[model samples]
Target: MKQFNQFAARPSAMSRALRKAFVYMTLAGTPALLSTAAYAQAVANDESTSATGVGAGDAALPTVTVNAAGESGQHLQTQSANGALGSRSVLDTPFSITSVTADDLADKQILKLGDVFSNDASVSDNSGGYSAWASYITIRGLPADWQNSFRIDGKPFLGYGITLPYDHFERIDLLKGSSGFMYGFGTPGGLVNYISKKPTDTPVRSVSVGYTSGNIWSEHVDLGGRFGNDQMFGYRLNATHDQGETFNEGYLRRNSVSLALDARLTRDLTWDFQSIWQNSNSDDQTPSIYTANYTGATLPSVISGGNRTLVGPGQHLNTNFQLYQTGLTYRINPDWKANLSYSHSSARRNRNEQTIYLKNAAGDYDNYRSDYLEAHTYDQWQAMVEGNARTGFLEHQLVFGASWQKQVNDYTVNSIYQLSGTGNIYAQNTNAYYSNTALRTYHAGEITQQALFASDTLKFSERWSVLAGLRYNQFEQNAFGIGGNRTSTYSKNATTPTVALMFKPEPNTTVYTSYVESLEQGGTPSLGQDNYGQQLKPLTSKQYEVGAKTSQQGWSATAALFRIERAAEYTLGNALVQDGQSIYQGLELGGAYRPAPQWQLGASLMLLDATYKKGSTFTGNRVAGAPKNMATAQIAYLVPQVAGLKLMADAKYTGNTMLRAANDIELSSYTLFNLGASYTTRLGKYDTTFRAAVNNLLDKRYWQYQYENYIKPGDPRTFSVSAKLDF
Candidate 1:
């Protein structure tokens, strides 16, 4: 057999035999499925619903819709008889919004947050085996953090993190492109809004349990019901638990759990309350970046291994984040509504290391302390009222609203230090005297944005309409003085105007063009420079995009072209230091194609040319970790009905790109494949499924996923078999 990769293992005889059988069976079902597709042409406009076991006439199903994120918030589609409640989903607009329905998730046996990204070719996650909490997403080949915003049921949250769980959400809406206008402060990297399940007007009782390979287990239950003839009172409760272990020893064992509740007190008043607590602990077997092990593979270690960089015996990372939220909505009337919501998240993370590495010229690689500990408790509250109606000069509609959002990060630990790589080293820390206390440190100021906004959608004619929006914002930041309370505050007034023309000649197609801008605070100050505070300023960026979208029957697709420009950016800083200022720009082309009711294909390509024109910020140097050319594509096909047997196969490939623009240091491109299948049957009244999935089927090896490499590697091939029971 031809060699595949450092981590690659030859396919077993059983696996090969199964693949052959599946190929033949799937080929046999192709025609039947094709015929089904023809019948679906009549309802193709609503076809994205195919996987959910619902037809255009499935009026018996309950209402499950989200109006909080993406353009989808502008289009409402659900299984309810009275029509979808709340806002319209992005799928109906010119913008791109891909929504994964609950039924589709169940059919695919998706068990975690990471699994969902498989459906979106425009996204990437690099924190494979080291830490599930280290998950990062990229769009249009932009630095994963370029400019992306995140929302949960219309509520906005900032910072970097991973998905909590899939069990609590009814669906996930991926709103591609700049979402800053509605999400408040955020990156340019589109947006992801997790719509949690809410209270229903009818009672429902369901529970499920899933067990996967790698010592994985999951249990979830949801109960909801209504009281009174008018059903003025309703409540819903949800809970889930997950725990698992991986194939690698160092990169093992993780879990999360949470609960949510919703109550409707009256026709005009309602409340949503939720609480979640989760903990993730692992050895962080960080893989290698520029280098690899005895095997010629350059890919980072799939798991943190090697006795040399022990990071200390029993070294591990511990992370815990908890959240609480409450919201009140008043219908006020049929055409108008108002809402007030407050969300809070407290996170505590710590890394204990006992690793040995080459730290100095003495050819000595010893135990060293590299700390990026974080402890933050942030909160955001917003209140807004909006109304919609039809009138003259417009046959369409209108929506106008205003609100305030406030977020504050507390006890921010932004510091760096050096320490022993091993516990058995001669450089044992003098806990007796606490030497080497001279490590550098600095504190960051609070970032705040207060704004006033308004928007209007005018239907000038049947084929054209104008979306006009304006926002006035006052931004301020204070960088706290190190070792002292001295602080410097920087403030600015900014205005953003948005105008777009949407053309829709048919019910399932829309094409639109729009422009948006975003601003973010800069980095650390200069070391030994007691007050490097006043010199740092906020970085501002502008982006222009034009995209067209079409969705019908069970098929949805979108094509977009985008350009992003960054005028001010910070560079090279160490322990509270100021290093460089630069300008960045890039062009993007992307699309998602789901041609079949049971299969889909998609990809995105981002070409970038960025530089620091003046003053040697990176001075003629390409930025690190900012790859020049990057694109990923995948195809998924499902096996047709074979009694209780089903099959699925997919492949994803990433192109080579720069880890840093400077020196052209490149992180070569790579690709991976995935295959899965499940068997379903009914044991009495209970429904059950047995599934097995193998990721990175080829197990190719390569360097780290980012310019920082930071001693973290990508994930290796792993196989998991699971079973789920629903009753």
Candidate 2:
């Protein structure tokens, strides 16, 4: 039987199976799309609602209409895409999840992914702020890997040193815990999926202008519509330009464009195409410190406001990013469908960075500079089929799919990295630049992955159900030296599985317990380490969770108790190694309530205990950068007398974090507050909205740190204002 299994798993056999599955789905469709019914014609635009459960809609899957209170800031009441399992209402999913819509982001004036979940207690911003090298976050006390944790429309994307264009997406979804069975190989921390905006059924035109601190200004334009005699063609276009000085005394200029187009080839078939382009240039970045240098000593004094960039006089960075995707969807029948898609993503970066090494508590430091040109590209192809069926007394919703992805990394062979000058964080430097001569680019690394997945949700009764999923993955990683010699190679195959049992005690209320396993890429040594560039073996993780959810007309709430265990990596004797296990156990609570029509309230809290279970050097130590407690509260009020005015206040608190595995130093906990107001009214023939906000209202001065040795100053108080018009 074992020999038969190996023979059946060959490429040709798998190809035949895939073809048979596709044919089966095509034959089983209802053939109702050919009918001239109103429902059939409107099906193309009725995909699922945004994560906020209202307004914008997801373009990748079928959607349902969800009514929402105007600008109430209520989220988590709708369905969201769950990888191979298709889309399901949040209340029915066994895992922890959160969805934020474009409306909420625009209302809050958020442009950075690091701040996307500022109000969520289970998440923490690890990139330090907009000035950090890249944007990243920690979910449930585990750091998310950039290469595997981010997806755009269900396709993998490489985000090493770049930030995605937030304006191009209609909604963002976060799935917490191990999701290997759902999304192939990934970090055990969680997953972040971006749902791109699609053409709207109704004509939409909008323009906006905004201003931020330091004389920075921005302009954006959005247009969408459907055309043709049969209204079979739809298009959506967005363009943005930003130029201004940063609050940290730096200058930035950026431009981005996105276009989405769809065509109905037949009554039941649709084709979608999307493309995005972005370019950015920035100068005088905030200086970051190597906190590991001060391991057992008192930390340096916090640098506040624009004074934090003492050695950033000549630092600069330039980046270009592009993405293209095309897909075909066949809505066979109301209960069955099939999809095929391909996507390509690329990012190129050129930067001159300066790093500081702390010398004492008096703010003295040594500075170093480096120049580099690096590029990364990712390509993916996916195919899937989904349908519902009933056998005897049991009903099933099934999903099956296959996907392949390849990512390549390239870097300049002669990139420069060395000490340029010495300086103190308390004083400014006039020249901290280093010039590098361009050289030939070399292949640095490559990663390829293939996966086959299947899932089924079986209903035993109206109040009880079970969900089971499995995924088989084949992964390979290759690293090459400047001479084109293969330095290291790692390849492996594994199967991840997930199982959940759910019960509905009352309408709109669900309780569930789930278990899942994950496989993740191993760690590589950092630049200054003894065994730099060495790659470790693959890691595995497991998660157990129990959660409950409920939603009503005026309020919604979610609670989860979870425990996760995963392989841990740390430096020992100046060499990085993988040993022991990092265990995380936590409780999470989130809810939004409306006591009166004029008042809206929301809050969330998380308590976590993360530690290394057993290791020679770091046994029983708290995981670096993991905080024990986090909380957030927000309130918004709509004026009764004033026609269209709203006032809002939000607060976020982060607990003290460990700086290293030794637990010798700690970064103090901090709280931030924000206030904002918006007014909407009609002027002449156009609808207008004016907004103003103050972030970090108290000008709190503090230091933010992540992992073993990254530290930077938190953002200072800033003011912003914007006016938007819809005509």
TM-score to true structure, per model: 0.74, 0.89
Clash number for each model: 57, 3
Candidate 1 on 90-142: residue-level lDDT in tens?
Answer: 63343455577664455445534445665555555454444433445555444
Global local distance difference test of model 2: 0.77
Off by over 4 Å in 2: 1-74, 132-134, 437-439, 573-575
lDDT over C-alpha atoms for residue 482 of model 2:
92
lDDT of each: 0.51, 0.77
Model 1 has an lDDT value of 0.51
For residues 149-171, could you state the per-residue lDDT of candidate 2 as single tens digits?
88887777766666666766898
Q: Which candidate is the best by TM-score?
A: 2
